[model samples]
Target chain A: MLILHCPHCDRMVDETDLHPGGEAHLKRHGPEADAEAFENYLFMRENPKGVHFERWRHVYGCGKWFLAARNTATLEVYGTYPAQTHQPPQTIRDTITERQPGWAWGDFR
Target chain B: MSEPVSALRGRATSGSVQVSDMGLQGMISLRCDLSFGKLKALSKDLVGAPVPALREAQVRNDRAALWMSPDELLFLMPHTEVDDALSRIAKAMKDQHHLALDVSDARALLRVEGPFAREVIAKLAPVDLHPDVFGPGQVLRTRLGQIAAAFWMTDAQTFQVICFRSVAHYAFDLLEASAKAGPVGHFPRGT
Candidate 1:
């Protein structure tokens, strides 16, 4: 039931209007990578209770994919940005830090 | 060389509003960076209207340019003018990275007219249809019940909805049902 802003369309859209695309910012393991690395890349996921980053498609709106940073525990959406971005913008990380203090996710702080 | 027929063959429905198939309309799917300088000029030359701003439509008389996405626009004109429009676009943007195609036959256009037009569409799409929030010149690509559709206001009391021709009958029936479902009074009648 979350109403999230779509960075591409600049519209606040209903959750029903969006399609969740699982976790974001996963590193890829190519054909040369070890079995363990490939398995982790394919199936391993972080289930952090706070400050989760995920992909979402504006399936009903602009039909573009975007990334969202939100607090899973409180349903507070920190921000959303275009899918082309490799990392959450500095401002969103700063916002998360201001609330959670010293919080970091994988390689992003 | 052969006769072109619209989906549903120009069906019309009456309830609180007038819903009818707008018949075959010429639509061109143009995908390119909107900021390309020549795009604005060439589109104006082809459609008699400037390329629309985000979520807006640039329209003049029987022609309109509707913003479909960050890098896409759907141009509308008379059905007979499609081939010429495609050629003009090809010639104008030949040197640029662009994709232009005639989509006139791939979709159906429906018109809903009456004071309750907004409410009728609102009953289906998740868009906020308040007059101030959505009115003439604003185009929205959104879901209509179970289908993907785009719609825009031609005037305060008129709306034009475009959906895939494969779903034309379903879209028309949805609009008709919404129109007959009786107003929820979410928006005042005749506003």
Candidate 2:
């Protein structure tokens, strides 16, 4: 079992529990979001071919969002970060924080 | 020779597009303290072996499948025997600081097996389905589509997937999509 460090939690978990959220740099606009907007947010995907930065959640455990760099072809993860501060994009950090979520998590459930 | 081969294989010997009506229809929620004595003995007796206090999954063939939590287990059985099992668990667990609940209506169980079942499991859930990673008698509390599912690998080719009755449709859709992708080539890739 591979344990990955989630930026938000600053910890590791068995790959079994964490849900891969695809690419995660979309900004949440308004309350009454439209179907097109929601579709773009949900269905539409970046599907990068190289080193890609994406958002993830410690869904089953911590509920925090993370910035993870992964290789698309090899499926090797390079690094991960918390949704806390603004960091300059690195060769590995591809997904910039467009509009950071108020909190990178829901609850500590 | 054809008769002999057919007889050797019963209804489902398993191959491409094989289907088995897995007739499991009940679930029981068991909350017992691993630190407790009576409950541990009862679990061992029922399983006919020592119940690992903290392992996630254990199986004893068709008789039962056991799961371990921090201090809980959810046992599934045939619908008709739910009450009997519950009472048995209760009687065995008396004088112990544990809770046993019959959550039969909380979730539904289905067995989806074939070469393609793991491919379907890869889409929404996150568990290592490879035999080396997820061996037989392993269980995981994960999601299937949007519904929470408890997955149990009963054997190399058979798996039991469970979810609340409400989101059964989504599970079916995901399974269909996985089948379309492949029988073995459909495992989940990294995001």
Candidate No. with top DockQ = 1
Q: Which DockQ values do the candidates obtain, in the order shown? A: 0.71, 0.09
- List runs of model 1 lying over 4 Å from the truth: none
Model 2 chain B lowest lDDT segment of ten: B2-11
lDDT of 1 by residue, A1-109 (tens): 7888898888888888899999989888988999999999999898898889999999877789999999999999999999999999999998999988987788888
Give the per-residue lDDT digits (tens) of candidate 2, residues A20-106: 776655556454899888777666666656445566666664455676765565566667777553442453333322222121221
Per-candidate interface C-alpha RMSD?
Answer: 1.1, 6.3
Candidate 2 Cα outliers beyond 4 Å, as residue runs:
A1-109, B1-21, B45-49, B184-191
> Clashing pairs in model 1?
none
lDDT scores in order: 0.90, 0.57
> For model 2, what is the C-alpha lDDT against the true structure?
0.57
Q: Tell how far residue B60 is off in model 1, in angstroms.
A: 1.8
Score chain A of model 1 by TM-score against the reference chain A.
Answer: 0.96
> TM-score of candidate 1 restricted to chain B?
0.97
